[model samples]
Target chain A: MFGKKRVAIVGAGVTLFRRNLKETGKELSYEAAKTALEVAGLELRDIKSVVMGSAPDAFDGVHMKGEYLADGAGAYHKPYTRVFVGGGTGVFTPLAGWWHVASGQFDTCLVVCEEKMSSCYPHPQYAFTTIFDPILERPIGMNLIWIFALEMNRYMHKHNIKKEDIALVSVKNKRNALDNPIAQLAANITVEDVLNSEIMAWPVQRLDVSPTSDGAAAVVLASEDVAKEVTDNPVWIDGVGWCIDSTHWTDRDLYYPDYVECAAKMAYKMAGIKNPPKEIDLAEPYDPFDYKELHHMEGLLLCKKGEAPKLTREGVTQRDGDLPTCPSGGLLGCGNPIAAAGLMKVCEIFWQLRGEAGKRQIPGDPRTGVAQAWGDLMQYGSVIVLRR
Target chain B: MRYYQSEAVETKDIKEGKIPTEKFRPKAKFAWSAGIAISRFLEELKNGKIIATTCSKCGRIMVPPRIYCEKCFKPADGWKYVKDTGVINTFSVSFLAADASRLKEPIVVAIINLDGASEGMGIVHRIEEYGDWREVKIGMKVKAVWKPPEERTGAITDIAYFKPIRE
Candidate 1:
């Protein structure tokens, strides 16, 4: 229901996620873009426009990173644009691609998301220090983990949830990662292992967090006309939505994510989904932190507030269960390369819907899936619904 | 599905010049303007006072004052001095520094809702002088401790840290 022209994701590709990738950001972008083009049975010349998504300039240590990555993203000598919404850029980039085709401006668009977080000296977390208010919050010497801990603490306190309930996510996701060929931190760990892991911040152990990584993911979007000619299994982009909350994250209640709910509602409405818990076959809500999957599930209206932990406890979110969430291992299991991680979730949904997830595939015939990405100081949410 | 490609590198590869990479350390320093509202707030902090903006349209008082009310999309009506004491909204005990390095003493940080500001209008700052981080709880009463006037600077750091108000 996107105007006169509909957009479809015909092909998608992703590079291996790692702590320190040897390839430059451009090379990673080229690897992902080339694969996507190859999968779509299209050449670089077939693309009419290009959209690039990267996190921060600080992460790559290069200003005008979009221009620097243009050639690698196959945007050379074409209409190109870069979109940024912190961590939301991955899923958001495809939304930009949708517009390029939906607006009838271009029949085909290339969407690429890349991040080289390891390039930052000492540690990539240092690049995050500049994300705070230089005058106010920066002086306090904030680590990115602290805000997550603060929010996790508030969420647990509000729901009377225990650390054990949250650790199960780590256990489930990492185990799921073992089936993923490109997974970086895949393991068969127990909940106790998560609780016993190193504590970076109270309520946020190291294992609860996804590792800093470098990688790239790319997807090819085309009009319905072009999609039918390109691939037999074209995943239609049924709905796309994004919402950004106020920048004053400190002033807002951290117990729940209201912004994600807003964005999810927008996409759900467009997709004509009356009951998200039933209509959507599977979901890939961002899981940079283990608690985030539950938080976003509630936000996405897949479950009621304070209900996700119970759902997880019941194994309802397992790959073969009633609703398989993050079946592609998620950011916790698949390394988090920020922009690439968000795009990876979109890629996972595209593959799952096409019955190409291999060992990580859900058992049932899943037709519709939702992928979401959260970013920008915990204030941004991007959602896309795809149907095969 | 099997076409995923990437090469992982270790720190030693770059450190020993084995990766054939060039390292550049940027020295880009910035003087961020505290802007219209925060400029006055910082000045007040140096004078040992906490100020907040009042939005008559929305009937909300905000800390870390802003020239315009973000909610109402208009200039705030005026400024008000909020009490130094407030309740802790949330807190975290951080064992790691900004660079992901371990710290000898874990820093306890909290978002404190100033007494007279609107509900949930809090400022992020460190919580200190507590025997243990577990003692710091949400809804706990606390007050800001300012640096000596002689050493005060017109910045958020003017207030050293927020401490628990012992009954």
Candidate 2:
């Protein structure tokens, strides 16, 4: 929480998100880490510490995976730690890096996140069955799609939201992803096309879901002094906070993403911002599901409750619109590689703050941005605030 | 994307995923990691015994016990054995095998909170001799059907499944 140690992102790198890559998890991590080091104009020896993240060892079919990935990420002979929060790991990785530098303990930290959802036999979607209570939830033939559809159904029923309104997010975000080089499902489509897609779950059509992907992303974070000497544009890590609500999701209200609200409050307070929509220029809220993006928008205070959907249709969330949301084409359009999706959001913020996002840049000179990821039984929210 | 224009199921090139074929590699052995005392307990059920641990600080009975009680912020050192019989807290019939693996016959996987354990301490297990999986329901009484002594393997499958108590 100290103000003077200011952690800044000097460079960022990412591998293309795809269904399958000949690369293993370590290879993916190495590819991204190499790009980040090159972009930062530094070598492996220049990094002082390391922060690694991956969603679950179950998906990679390798346990203690962070340790296994250390050498490839250039963490050998360096202070390293792994942070996990299911899907929140991607965002949590950088937050761990921020603490390493902000604590005046380390000058530079390599933040890397990798997810390989293809290793599990059969469809990797089967792995999500284990996320629920093995006793009550699992025995009922429950899968991740059911939970998402349930959330979508509840969100639609409560606010008079429609299938068409939700489809707009898929249309908007996928269209935006066309500019992202790492994007896996970037496409130009209309709401009509989305509605006609195969229905996985009643309310959740296949198009509503993010593509399962294998990918990795990394960013170089350093203290103020080190950042100033490394690059002309350093995106500062202004505030970071994460929250986890009770795992008993049935006992809580599904209409609002309360965990996200709590996480946003903690982050907003640290960033010294009282107004989110007016003050924060860009936001990359998690969009593993199209409705989730809208749900998190309200939770992140970008709009009032139930206002996110209406706001999106009004073009308020477009790149040149009032408060650009998911300008990097979120998980729905880009790709959702489990834990790596969150770090991708942080990279988007870095690119936008540095004015390096060529075709995806938000209008005007944006100074502050927020990135968030929420997952794990729909209970955890990881939020980060950035500035230049 | 691989595409087919058939109106029927085609099984070719489905990646016959019974263990990957990195082209004829030996099956490597694996071990469950630390904090698997619960896993060990499930394995021990092959001997027709149930195990649970008691927290030294809070004294709550844990089944498939936790080595550490997160509530007390310390290790749960005291351990005890529980009876294999337990009341069903909840249960369900799994109709699909995640990735379309038909169960041949759908299986009944029940979560029973064993006797003398915490309020909701239990494990999911198959229900043996239930005939139809649909017959199993919440609150049904079931007992551990242990494997024969000579055929024990120290694993969840060793318990066979939970069969209804004979009247």
User: By TM-score, who's the top model here?
Assistant: 1
lDDT per residue for candidate 2 within A279-335, as digits (tens), equals: 899999999989999999999999889888999899888898988889989998778
Docking quality level of the chain pair in candidate 1? medium
| Candidate 2 chain A worst ten-residue window by lDDT | A134-143
DockQ of each: 0.77, 0.07
Query: Candidate 1 lDDT (Cα, whole model)?
Result: 0.91
Q: Assess each prediction's global lDDT (C-alpha) against the native.
A: 0.91, 0.79
lDDT of 1 by residue, B1-167 (tens): 53466888887888888888877899888998889999999999999999999999889889978988887899998999999999988899999999899998899999898999999988999999988787888888999999999999898989999999999
Q: How much is A320 displaced in model 2, in angstroms?
A: 1.5
Best by lDDT: 1
| Model 1 ranges with Cα > 4 A deviation | none
